[model samples]
Target: MTRPGFSAVSVLGVCLLFTLSGCSGTPAPAPTTGSASATATATATASPSPTAPTSQAVTPSPTATAPPSSAPPSSAPAGPTETATPTAEPTFTGFPEQTGPLTIYYVAIGDNGVSGPMIGCGDSIVATTTAPVRFTDQVGPSLGTLLVNKSRDVGLSGLVNVLYQSNLTYVGGELVGSTINIYLSGQFMLGGVCDIPRAKAQLEYTAMAASGATSAQVFVDGRPIDEVLSLK
Candidate 1:
């Protein structure tokens, strides 16, 4: 009986002490655990790329330039040309020597084959053979009279086609009354006519001066005659 009564009192006292100790020793509950978080960061680097190779352009060569001219480049000189002096046209420096144009006065007295003659050319007073010169009213009863002067008497005038051409004419002469006249045509030597003889002329006369005068004597190259000559 005694033992049971003491245990109840002790058990009550021990319970009250345990309650006070627990209140004092307990720590504040860990702050609500903050939401756990972990963040990761990444960094990147860049490098430059190499450039491609390029090709170069080609150049042209220079050419030589020519001199300016009206025509073109040349080695010839420009100016008056040197011409050979036209050889002094083979001159006639002395007697009987002929060069440029020439004219001569001739007389035939030394040669004997020439004498009085009556003659005429178409529309021109030519010469007179050994016959009286026929006169007419239109021709005024007289063909021109002859003179003894050289170049003053009747000169040979006719077409070169019918007379002198490509030749030299040498003439002999004499007097007729108070007149001088040529009986023969010429003393010409032409390359074309040399081989051929000279042409002869016809003589027609009827005393135009004194009637019944001596029938004039005709002559050629100095040969006296009383007839007309035909030249062919």
Candidate 2:
């Protein structure tokens, strides 16, 4: 009897087909076309991208700079500065020379005429010559020229000398510092009271002028001229 569905040979043939299919390599699954395709898309989206060699961004360091100076810039043109000049000193010279004709003082009557006191007599100037290096040496000779009694003897007229017959002699004259000292040996004779001052004026004026000094002291016979003149 035959089965209702398949014959025995057919059934065995079907079994053999299944066995061979199983022995073969596993069959590729059919291309997903619905829910499986969706599942594969989700897995691909969840995976991380192949980072492109992961190039690290290198940050460069900042450049250094110098700070600004506080000083202001100069506007003037550059050049050499001027310096001050020194002053020169003055030159030195020597002392002055003293040489010339000497002056002598003699007695002369005043405008009041000869009737006036000899004390009121004026002075007359006379010139004499002597070769002397110093004023002291010139004084003696100048005084000697003055001792003459008459003014006419010295080439002058109208002038009188109270020492006419006085016989006063010039001994010497000396200058110590600024002072003038005169020595004489004589007999002072005054004819009248006025003759005293006349004699003093003649001797003192002549000595002072010759010595170029302001004052002079006269000595007669080692006595002061004041004492000798006063005795007259």
In order of listing, the candidates' clash counts read 21, 0
Quick one: best TM-score, which candidate?
Answer: 2
Residue clash pairs of candidate 2: none
lDDT of each: 0.33, 0.68
Query: Could you give me the TM-score of model 1 versus the true structure?
Result: 0.17
lDDT of 2: 0.68
The parts of candidate 1 lying over 4 Å away from their true place are 1-54, 68-86, 93-228
lDDT of 1: 0.33
Winning candidate number (lDDT): 2
Q: What tens-digit string does per-residue lDDT give for candidate 1 at 1-232?
A: 5564657779888887898788888688764434222111111123434666668666777787856756544577765556777666686553332223111112222223233232222211123332343322211122122211113222452212112331212243333564333344324322342112222221213222322223333344665422323333
